[model samples]
Target: MRVLLVKLSSLGDVIHTLPALTDAWHAVPDIHFDWVVEEGFAEIPGWHPAVAHAIPAALRRWRRDWRSTRAERHAFRARLRAQRYDRVIDAQGLIKSALVARQAIGPRWGLDRASAREPLAAWTYRHRVRVPREQHAVSRTRALFAAALDYSIPNTVADYGLARERLPVPSTAPGDLLFLHGTTWPSKHWPEAYWCELMALAAADGLRVLLPWGDETEHARAERIAVAGAGHGFVLPRSGLGELAALIASARIVIGVDTGLAHLAAALGTPSVTLYGATRPDRTGTFGEAQIHLSARFPCSPCLTRECGYRGASVVRPACYEALDPARVWAQTRETMSGSREMAHGA
Candidate 1:
């Protein structure tokens, strides 16, 4: 069976769909997938052996210059239509994703109106499957696949089904910690002071601290953190998703704010401590072996807001993060690392 999967953009969402592909592959051994993802994240789907093609959809880029990029968009659509897929699944139930699924050559399948994030997107699907919204994002996708493909949803843990060998292993020595501090939302940031303190704690424990950045703003923040560490920390050069994944795969431990890289670390099976400030862990938190989630304890926490609304001058920069002390995070990080090491030795 040939399938076309439409889950575009956002690194975390793309990673979340991998296990669903694994489930489908397990049910139908002859099944092959052709994933339509944001051009930036096209590398992800190919990491799974079940995926035969990773089609790049420049939707984000095309929207910026729709008139000028008409030819390119036409060419991509032509290429997509040329393939004869048996089914097209839109795991991402947004209007934009539904539109992408409609361009394919098979019966479109997606979440029903009652279960979709956007009710309007459900109308585009020829076959709509209702998946429970209360479950984690991973479980919802797995359930959607099971329902759409006429297979039973397994009662086991999620298997990301990515080959570790596809990513180049970093040369960094063992016991080195990688801090993924770059995130899209301001409210999700762990305080810079807390990061510095955590670096100092890791340095005292003889662990080398490495900070990875995405943009200019994150680069500057990473430099400041490195400077604050005085000699114990180093800022990594700007890296693509694959390079960063390689680094994460090699790191002894990853301590990160709620970001896609944190999710990538968890998916890579790296021991990690993910600090949550404004978001709740029950719905979208990173989940895997040795992955620890630490959520804030403030009343206004998990507000799911993009910006900090606390107005008190006496409060921390992001007051929600104040509840997560760096010392406590460090303690958890150490415990997770120790447990991972023991497991590795036992295996």
Candidate 2:
């Protein structure tokens, strides 16, 4: 069976869909997938063996320079419509994703109005699956696939099904820690001073630290962290998603704020500690073995706000992050690493 999956943009959401692909592939080995994802994340779907093609959709880019990118968008749509798919699943139940699914040549399937994040998007689908909203994002996607494909949802752990061997190992020694501090939201950031303290703790523990960055702002922050590391931490060169994945796969442990790279690390089966500040991890936290989520216990936490709204004394900073002390994070990191080792040794 040929299927077209529409889950575009944002690294974490795209990664969350991988397990569903794995489930579908295991149930029907002959099934092949053609995934439509944002151009920036097009490489993700190809990581799964069952995905035959990773079609790049440039809705975000096109909206910026519609006239200049008209030809490219036309070409992309042409390529997408070239093959007739047996079914098209809109796992991302947003208007933009639903519109993308409509462009394909198949009966569009998606979450029903009651279950969809955007009720308007449900109208675009020929078939709507009623998935619960309270479940984890990975589980929701798996359930959606099972309902759409007419198969029983398997009661198994979420398997990302990424080809780990495809990534080249970096020249890093064992016990090295990768710090993922770059995130989109201000509220999601762990205090810089806290990061420095964590680096010092890692240094005392004789573990080398590596910091990866995305943009100039994040790069500057990483540079500061490296400087504060006192020769124990170093800033990594700007890398693409694949290269970062390779780095994460090679790391002994990863300490990160709530970000897509953290999710990627968990998907890669890396031992990671993800600190949650502004957002709650109940539904969207990383799902994998050796993954630990440390949520902020502040009263105003999990507000899900993009910007920080703390009007208290400047000394207090963001109260949400105070509970996640660097020492506490380091302790958890050590514990997670030790647990992972024990599990590997059948302890």
Compute each candidate's TM-score over C-alphas. 0.97, 0.97
**Tens digits of per-residue lDDT for model 2, 38-128:** 8899888878898999988888879989999988988988987998999999999999999889988998899999999999999999999
Which prediction has the highest lDDT against the true structure?
A: 2
Show where candidate 1 strays beyond 4 Å. Answer: 169-175
Model 2, residue 42: distance off in Å is 1.3
C-alpha lDDT of residue 57 in model 1? 92
- Per-residue error (Å), model 1, residue 75: 1.0
> Which tens-of-lDDT digit does each residue in 231-346 have in candidate 1?
87888776777778888888899999889888888888888899998887778889777889998888888889999998865356688877899988998988988898889899
